[model samples]
Target: MNKVSMRFLMSMMLIVGGYAFAKAQSAQSLLKEVDSKVKSYKNIAIDFKYALSNEAQGVNQETKGNVVLKGDLYALNLLGTKQIFDGASIYTIVPEDEEVTISAVSDQDENAITPSKMLSFFNDGYIQKMDITQKVNGRTIQYVKLTPMDSNSEVKHTLLGIDTTTKHIYRLIIVQKNDTKITITVNSFKANQPMSANAFVFDESKYADYYINKI
Candidate 1:
């Protein structure tokens, strides 16, 4: 190719490369900002709707849940079950079975999804790209897509929707390798809410009839 043609091609490539770099950097910065805003809250209470579906399998399910988070501690109520994390041990209470399972927290488990992880899990092991922005209910929501670095991961990718004005998470969509999709939509979010002193503490007295299985 002539010098002029080669130079034009190189210039085009440079522009495209620069744009990609800037887009990636913007996605990271926006996610970090959201994390900062979430961590600043003393406590947070969120009511959410969860939906899971697999079109190929004809499986569909929907549920509503709520969670209260304070630092690394969290209390989640879902499917008639309650899970509490006291920063050390995780207490999972199953009322239908009248049992409670206690286990140690394993931060090294990358596949585990907890309230804290939901906020900052994209910090590592993923390539983030700024996806799209949409207006819903008079608010602007910006989405970021994260593809796992591990090819063996069951999850194909995850999309996080953040409220641009409040920097709070609005939704999370997890697309699995098998084409199963799980979407969690935040119905309501309350930050810095006043929580009881023992919100994250599992009181056995409340479930006296339940079996306490400590592992």
Candidate 2:
């Protein structure tokens, strides 16, 4: 090619490369801001709608749940079950089965996104890229696409949507390798509210009739 054509090609490449770099930097910066905001809160309470669907399998389910988080502790209630993580152990209480299973938090899968880690799971083990933005309920939702770095991970990709005005997570969409999609949309988010002393504590005595299994 002539010198003029070569110069134009180089200029175009540089422009494209620079734009890509800036986009990545912007995404990382936004995520950092979100993390900082979350850390600033003493605690968080969230009510969300959960949906799981697989068109190929003809499976669809929807439910609602709520969770309260403080530091490494969290209390989650969903689908007639309540799970409490008390910084060290996890207690899963099933009302239908009338059973309570206790297990150490260390025994849980490291890659599993537990209730306590839902907001901050993207801090590692994933590649973050800025995705599309949309207006939801008069609020701006910015989506970040996360691709798992582990090739063997069951998750195909995840989209985390943050409300730009509040820097709070608005929605999470996870697509599994088996083509199942799970979506969680935040209906309400409250931070720094007064919590009861026993909010994160499990009272085994109250479940005297239920069988307790410790693992």
Candidate 3:
């Protein structure tokens, strides 16, 4: 090959290699940024507008509620109804029926420690893979897929809608093994706020009457 032809071929190879390297680096940086932000917040409480659809069962439910999660304690205020997980016990309050069901955490294997379970995600065996970017309400989000390394986990895989500009998790889609999909949208989210210890407690006496269930 002549000198000009050799230089041209080398330049093309360099360009291709540079593009590939940049793409890989970008993905890594985004994942790292996500981890950093999640790690920084130890406790979080947010109000969510949730849409749940069970395709197999043909059931759809929509609910709006305020969720407070502080470390191990948690509570959900929904439609005059409340569900509280006070570390050792689980309490469900229904105002209409004027009843409360209290169950031990050890007995209830499937407890909701998710969005309301305010523990910091360790990001241990979870894998973060990049997906396609899509526009949500005019905000362009980079799709990042998350799969738990442990198969025993209740969650199948979570699709995260990450705001590219703010680099925050706008929404999360959680799919259970039974194919139940729950889309949780953050109506309003605030992080690192000084949550009073009282926030996580369930005021049982506030309700008119409550029932107890052991099992």
Q: List per-prediction Cα lDDT, in the order shown.
A: 0.91, 0.94, 0.72
- Report the lDDT tens digits of candidate 1 across residue range 75-167: 999889999999899999998999999988863374756776877787889999999999999999999999999999999999999999999
Which candidate ranks first by lDDT, i.e. highest? 2
| Candidate 2 error regions (>4 Å) | none
Q: What would the per-residue lDDT of candidate 2 be over residues 63-140, giving only the tens digit for each residue?
A: 999999998899999999999988889999999999999999889999998898899998998998899999998999
Q: In model 2, what lDDT does residue 206 have?
A: 97
Which prediction has more favorable TM-score, 2 or 3?
Answer: 2
Cα lDDT over the full model 1:
0.91
Q: Residue 149 CA error for candidate 3 (Å)? A: 2.9
Q: How far is candidate 1 from the true structure (C-alpha RMSD, Å)?
A: 1.5
Model number with the top TM-score: 2
After superposition, the stretches of candidate 1 with alpha carbons farther than 4 Å from their true spots are none
Q: After superposition, how far is residue 101 of candidate 1 from its true place, in Å?
A: 1.3
lDDT of 3 at 194: 84
TM-score of each: 0.94, 0.98, 0.69
